[model samples]
Target: MKDKLKKLIIIPAYNESECIEKTIENIQKNAKDFDYIIINDCSTDNTREICERNGFHIINLPVNLGIGGAVQTGYIYGIRCGYDMAVQVDGDGQHDAAFLQKMAECLEETGADMVIGSRFIEKQGFQSTGARRIGIRFFTWLIRLMTGKTVTDPTSGLRMVNRKVMAKFAKDYPKDYPEPETAVTVLHCGMKIKEIPVVMKERAGGVSSISMQKSVYYMVKVSMAIIIERMRRRK
Candidate 1:
């Protein structure tokens, strides 16, 4: 790992106490070389206690920042710590650590600023709910039509990025459903992006923050955000 660029895994947890340990264990077993930071987003559960007792490296936020803020904090830390690359993985144990190496390799070999671990690239694994799948397809078509880049899993949380992208994201990142809109920013900045086939499992514990009602709001918000991003000048 030292021979290559130093990599950091950023796992953001809200109330993922039940699965955080297993998620870390998976990373330790499958990708031991990379370092990791768990952003405890002011969780009400024992997520912070588990991290403390286990001596896991973590940033205990003073407030309950949403997923975007937690992940951006990780990128900021990565830049400050001189990490050459950073990967965002959920703390709910849905993301597979085994795919981290492949994403890193894609980033290095293709010189892409970011490589998204996608479930739809090969049409395998949990394909999400019917309503969410419709939103994903709409965003996929929107991104392709706007940037001419086909991103099958724009909503995927598992993604890896080089230092250049880390710096950009650390400075400014969306605080909501950001994966799709952030991809627009990457393209507008003349950065390259790629997606690789990866399998994702269902969450190990705790309910997803996005309820069925919130899913409708998420789709509308992200769709509008991506459109507004397209109209903006390149940064």
Candidate 2:
């Protein structure tokens, strides 16, 4: 199954000119058999230029759609190309590609619809700041309340999905609070999800979209979004 699986690494990049190259290079080194595409989310910097110069497979978005929209584009692209599985890895150099193959194997062996690389599972390597972990814990409790699934890292961008969930996400995915919201969506759809411990690196460059000032807003907004998604789950 591993030998026959066609996998795609969906990297959603925005203004990651400094880290995008390194991200791709890591994938090339670790998951060489798997193909990858950079969803260039209309970065103001020369991200597209760097990708083009390196001759990487890239889909240039006309406008900035944030993480959700950019990731959805990769799902749509993967479905059209007939990939067996796809994983979302942030282009900011925070997510390491070394764990990608492990996630893929976990998906196949466990027959899970989604597999997440979780930093909190082992509590090793660049665990996000304390304030961020508090927010993460809140979402973890919220997700468990809504779907009975305990996700140690609901905010993690490192996730792999099979073709079925890939198609669903391509059609309908949230623009905000996507990770937690989509976890609820998947659980409500009767799909299985698994998590593997992974150590994430600190961002090599570029400011995070979520700032200290925005943390409160992020928590409140995502909590509301998770509740709404739970209510909207398919019956």
The candidate maximizing lDDT is 1
Clashes of each: 0, 0
56-145 per-residue lDDT for model 1 (tens digits): 999999999899999999999999999999999999989999999999889998999999999997878888888888888999999998
- Report clash pairs, candidate 1: none
Model 1 worst lDDT run, 10 consecutive residues? 226-235
| Model 1: per-residue Cα lDDT at residue 199 | 96
Over 56-113, each residue of candidate 2 has an lDDT whose tens digit, in order, gives 9999999889889999999999999999999998998999889988998899999999
| Candidate 2 vs. true structure, TM-score | 0.97
Model 2 ranges with Cα > 4 A deviation = none
TM-score, prediction 1: 0.97
In angstroms, give how far residue 101 of model 1 lies from its true place: 0.7
Candidate 1: how large is its RMSD? Answer: 1.4
Q: What is the lDDT of residue 27 in candidate 2?
A: 93
What's the lDDT for all of these models? 0.92, 0.91
